[model samples]
Target: MSLHELRLLPWTTPEGNPCYLSADSDHSALSRLADDLEAAQLDSGAQVLAGARAVLADPGAGERAVRFALTRAVESLDDALRVAVSRGRRIPARHR
Candidate 1:
């Protein structure tokens, strides 16, 4: 689901990790689904938002979509960190 459809309150933790609170704990499956979504290769903020919106709108949707969204989020964050490190030449100098 797009962030808008999911009504996600986007905020970062002290460590700069994006996180959200899900009140719909009745379905334990949603938790894992969220994790899977965070692991996907959603390389752009816009795509993540769009995908999240689509998932959140379908109340009857399977947990897979949630998983996909979570995957994307995580992948995006990982990409960001890699970029930051690369820009600073933090990796072994020889690797560059």
Candidate 2:
């Protein structure tokens, strides 16, 4: 959860250049965050893939995971949007 919250911090600085967090939190934390992101991406992708395969096997099971993943993604996005808006940052309209 700390790692996820760290990623919510901007990757680019105000000058639009990529930078890292203080040395106290270096690559290890970033790597863990990256791993988490990768896992989420894989989970979302696999959810779709499994759903597709389930369409041939047990339609209900496949539909359930896919719908759950989509719902999670939407909720995560909504939370991010609310945070950004509250912080006075520019958020995309779709997220609003």
Candidate 3:
């Protein structure tokens, strides 16, 4: 497979660069780990959304609480977007 076909992992390196997997298929141990991590990231993002919504609906939420919720929501959104882009790129061109 070409470099274009490399699987974008669910995480980055220590320097915060994107990571990729070069296995022939997505069944390798490392690929499986990546899959698991992606699932966890998505799940965490959903939880963060719920919390953020609750915070937004709370009229008494202080600035600190709103800021904290906003920060977490931004982070979860970034993760979710990364996951989307990675999965989208992995799709076959013909399927597009």
The count of backbone overlaps in candidate 1 is: 20
* lDDT values for all models: 0.54, 0.48, 0.88
Which is the leading candidate under lDDT? 3
Report the C-alpha lDDT of model 1 over 1-96, residue by residue, as the tens digit.
222223122334799865554444423575455434433333475577677778888897788888888787676666555444323432345776
Predicted candidate 1, C-alpha RMSD: 16.2
Give, for candidate 3, the lowest lDDT window spanning 10 residues: 1-10
* Number of backbone collisions per candidate: 20, 0, 0
Pairs with steric clashes in candidate 2: none
Alpha-carbon shift of residue 41 in model 3 (angstroms): 0.5
Which order, best to worst by TM-score? Answer: 3, 1, 2
lDDT of 3 by residue, 3-58 (tens): 44788888999999999888786678998898898899999999999999999999
Q: Using Cα atoms with residue i matched to residue i, what is each candidate's TM-score against the true structure?
A: 0.36, 0.30, 0.92
